[model samples]
Target: MSLRRRIAAVAAGVLAAPLVSVALPSAPAFAHGYISSPPSRQAQCAAKTVSCGAIQWEPQSVEGPKGLRSCNGGVAHFAELNDNNKGWRVSNVGRTVTFNWVFTARHRTANYEYYVGGQRVANISGNNQQPPATVSHTVTLPSSGRQTVLAIWNIGDTANAFYSCVDVNAG
Candidate 1:
């Protein structure tokens, strides 16, 4: 073949190489759920009038390790949320208070657990098959001056986790 033709062929080969190579797989997808009934409005009331005020919570996303890409990579986990001790604050005034939460998972099912003042209040596993889900629960205030409400979520296979909270009035 002619020198010019050979050079042209080499350049063509190099350019085409990228097209032949396979692309990296995309990260998995996850959904965010919603907080169920006893709507926020119903729960919201004068901190002094109600024995317990309304509380709302949700899972939060976090940054994951370097390069270890996953739908929830760098995402916060349930353990991390609690360890950080970051959540909503509520008053436990011995009134009937309600807690609500919702979230979705990616590539797998999710599990949720609720707690108040370090005591377990409710647990729901496999809430939904897809992302954008919702779950909730309610409890009475301890009649104490103030209380804390905690909500945690575990996404499927991936280590992604999140949590959030609201403050309620304690009677």
Candidate 2:
């Protein structure tokens, strides 16, 4: 090839390489899941029942390191969920109540845990498989009164878990 032609071909390849990369798709944001039934804190935010910050835009992103007891999964932008006086709507139910979880991105789960009054009330095994769009667990309240239930979704393949808090008046 002539020297001038070689220089032109090299320039064309270098310029096209940048355009090819720019046209490629980028990674998607990890928006997972949250509890909907009985209206978890994130649900309320998504529904506009409670005014929240960025969590309202993405209720299914309350993900963090496993074993976290925080409603917002310790995410700084969702700190409002950690507020005790956020005026969250409370759902009234019987001693035996069923909690429902809605998943946006189904993942292989290790287990599902529910806690009330600092005590675990139920632990449903996920069997290390992907769950359906929605999953439910029934648990009897320890006592009758207003309480906050913390629901946790432990991912089987990751060191993270999704957190949600539901206020309820169990009778």
Best by lDDT: 2
Residue 64, candidate 1: Cα error in Å is 8.2
Question: Across residues 68-150, which tens digit of lDDT does each residue of candidate 2 receive?
Answer: 88898989999999998999999999999888899889889999988987899989999999999998888888899999999
Measured on C-alpha atoms, candidate 2 has an lDDT of 0.92
TM-score of each: 0.43, 0.86
Best by TM-score: 2
TM-score of 2: 0.86
Q: Model 2 Cα displacement at 77 (Å)? A: 0.6
TM-score of 1: 0.43
CA lDDT of every candidate: 0.44, 0.92
